[model samples]
Structures are given as structure tokens and as C-alpha cells.
Target: MTTLQGKTALVTGASAGIGLATARMLSHAGARVICCARALERLQIQLDEMPGPGLAVELDVADAVSAASLPDRLPQDWQAVDILVNNAGSDIGGRQPFHEGDINQWAGTIQTNVTGLMQVTAAMLPGMLAREQGHIVNIGSTQGLTPVAGCGAYTAS
Candidate 1:
């Protein structure tokens, strides 16, 4: 990884798991990190303990209206994101036979895993384009590569 001394990284689903780890790693690498998730208080607690500067934001990527307004919602100083990690995803209803799966749950999974990622990226890309520099990391599951027995929605997303 290259030095990110002056960069700003925005990570989705940053309350825990891969998103949290990525935020910390970026902070350690010297970038200001914006950690976003549905639970602001929880995410803020983690951000407070990180090595470098970080901002905790409440964002439910599954909400289209919120996702569309994200760029404008950010503070002026933090708006110019240098890196974006689109890691907000869910395997709602978990593994089940396709015929036995709930359609609503499948929709939820697709909304979060696929549409949510696209919305956030679309929100942040303009700033990156204007600056002529940025990086995007879209976290994906191996289920996408190897067909799974009971994760049709997850694999498709």
C-alpha cells in the first residue's frame, strides 16, 4: 500500500467487520477516514479509538434517497474523498433453498448488496472525477465466483 498521508477515505458498512478494519488500516496509513454505517453511535465509538482522524456517519446505504444525498450531506472539508470503499452489504434471510426463500428478503439483499453499492459510488464519483484521482474498492463475496447451494440472492448480487 502506498502512503496516504493527505488522503481522505470513506468506507461504508464501517461499524464492524471488514469495513471497520479497512477504516482503521487507512487511518494508520495516514488518511483521514470517514466511517459510515446505520448505527452512528456504535461506529463513532470505534472511530474514537482509531489511530488517526476519523468521522463517524450514519448511513443506511439501502435507502436510495439517503444514498443520493450523501455527497451533499458530508461536511465541506470531508467532501473530497480520495478513496471509497463500497462494502455495505447483507445476506438477508441467510442461506435457504431458492424456492423456500422469501421474495421480500431477497429484495432486501439485492437492495443492500447491489443497488446500495451503486448508489454510494455514484454519489462519490463526481468528486473523484473533478479531482482526477481516487480509488474505489468494492468488497464482494466468493459466492459470486463459486455457485453456492443455498445463497441464490447473495451470489447473484
Candidate 2:
């Protein structure tokens, strides 16, 4: 647990819940934080509700082009991130039978959870490896951990 003084960190899904908590904690610990999520409205609301200096990036991690643009989006001076929290994911439309489900719903979930994670991690990795220092925390679903009926499709993919 470092103080994070003068460090730059990016936390995905930071507009709510665990992501929000971690971002705030990191800020308190002295990290220069960049909080990213899909919902601009929610992110703005969170930003307005909170107190202090953190960058809020309107990002859709599931979008590969956007994830690939990370280097371009980073502040020139603060391009080197010391911490990356890959916490963006969504369990949309609840637990429904695989047959009855839209199937398209699962795409977004997997794209965010699996593909998006890889893209973001890959994008940020060079910087970390170059400096030989960094930490990445990924959030995974409990359903993906076990045999849940609806989760079958999501877990399998």
C-alpha cells in the first residue's frame, strides 16, 4: 500500500460502487487520479458530488478504438500511469435463461469483461513495463466463478 504521492492512476467504472471507493481512497492517498466510465451523466454527477482533483474521462472500454487511443488521451506530463484498475463491467438485463436471452446482451458483457480488459491492459502495459513498475486490478463476476444457469452463456464465452 503505497502513498501514491505524485503518481498517476486510471480507474475504470469509477462513477460508482467499488470503483468509486477505490478512486476516492487513491485520491486520499495522494494519487493523481483519472476516473473513466461509459455514463457521462453519472460520471458528471459523481464528479459534481465529490470534492477534489481527479480527471474524469468519458470512455467506453468495450470500444477497441477508444481503448487503443489511451496514449493519445493521457496528459502529456502525466502519461506514465503507476496504477491501472480494470474494473469496468456490466451484468445487463439480469439473469435470464440462455435460450430466452437476446445473446447480444452477453456480447457487451464479455466485450467489457474480457476483450475490453485485454485491450486496456495492453494499451497501458508498455508504460508500466518501460518503468518496470505498476499495478492492475481486474474485476470479475461471481457468476463466472460457478455453475449458474443464466451465466452459462456468459461464463462460457
Candidate 3:
């Protein structure tokens, strides 16, 4: 392993599940990590359980105002971000046929999964480009690739 010992990485949706798994892998490679998620307590607990030191920030990607302000809110200790994993995503809340689905849930689904994903990525990518080195990983569901009748809504994610 070419040590990532001095590198800094950020893993979004790090409170649980796949984001947590990715963070663990990156940390094992010797990268310093900063975790973000809407659930602060869960993020805190996950960070505590991990084998290294990291910062946890509460973030809701659906909130444009908050997402826009992330660059300025980075910790003083964090300078350049070397690795970025855009793993924050959400499921749509309807299982009904596309016609019968709840309208608000449908809209919320796109807003969070698609629009919010873009917003967060836009805010971070510029910095990575400025540094000329970084990595981005987006988590996409299998349902998005192949249709599962009831999960079309979540697949819209």
C-alpha cells in the first residue's frame, strides 16, 4: 500500500450502512476521515467505533442553504480534501404505480436523490479540481439499473 497516511478524506452519509463501510475502508488505508450525515448521534457513534480519529458534521443535502455553506464550514484542521465519497442518498417513499404514487413523495425523491446529489457534488468538486487530485464515488442502487416492480419509486433514487 502506498500509504494514504497524510491524506484527508470525506465520506458523506457516514452514520450507517454503506457509507460507514466505505469510511472504514478508507481509514484502514491510513487516510484521515471526516464523516457527514443528517443524524449527528449516529455519526458520532460510528466514528467512535472506528479505529481512527475523524470529524463528524451534521448535514442535510436536501437543504440548499446548508449545502451551499459547506466549503466555509470545514474544520480549521482540515485543509485540502484528497478523497471524496459522495455516498449520501435517500429512498423515495412510494411503492404505488407511477400514476397512483403520492405526488409529494415523488418530488421529494428527485429533490433529495438527484438535485441534492448535484448540489453537494458541485460544492466539493471545485476544490478537488483546484488541487488537481481527488477521488469521487457515488452509490447507485441496483434497482436503478434493473426494474423491480414495487421498487420503482426507490429505484428512482
TM-score of each: 0.96, 0.87, 0.91
Per residue, candidate 1 scores C-alpha lDDT tens digits across 29-139 of: 999999999999999799888999999888999999889899889999999999999998899999999889999999999999999999999999998999999999999
Query: Candidate 2 lDDT, tens digit per residue, 106-138?
Result: 787778878888999999999899999998988
Q: Give residue 127's lDDT in candidate 1 (0 to 100).
A: 89
Candidate 1: list runs displaced more than 4 Å.
none
Q: Where's the lowest-lDDT run of ten residues in candidate 2?
A: 44-53
The local distance difference test score of each candidate is: 0.93, 0.81, 0.80
Task: State candidate 1's TM-score.
Answer: 0.96
* Weakest 10 consecutive residues of candidate 3 by summed lDDT: 91-100
Give the candidate order by descending TM-score.
1, 3, 2
Query: Looking at candidate 2, what is the lDDT of residue 95?
Result: 80
Judge candidate 1 at residue 40 and give its lDDT. 94
* Model 2 TM-score on a 0 to 1 scale: 0.87
In Å, residue 11's CA in model 3 sits off its true spot by 1.2
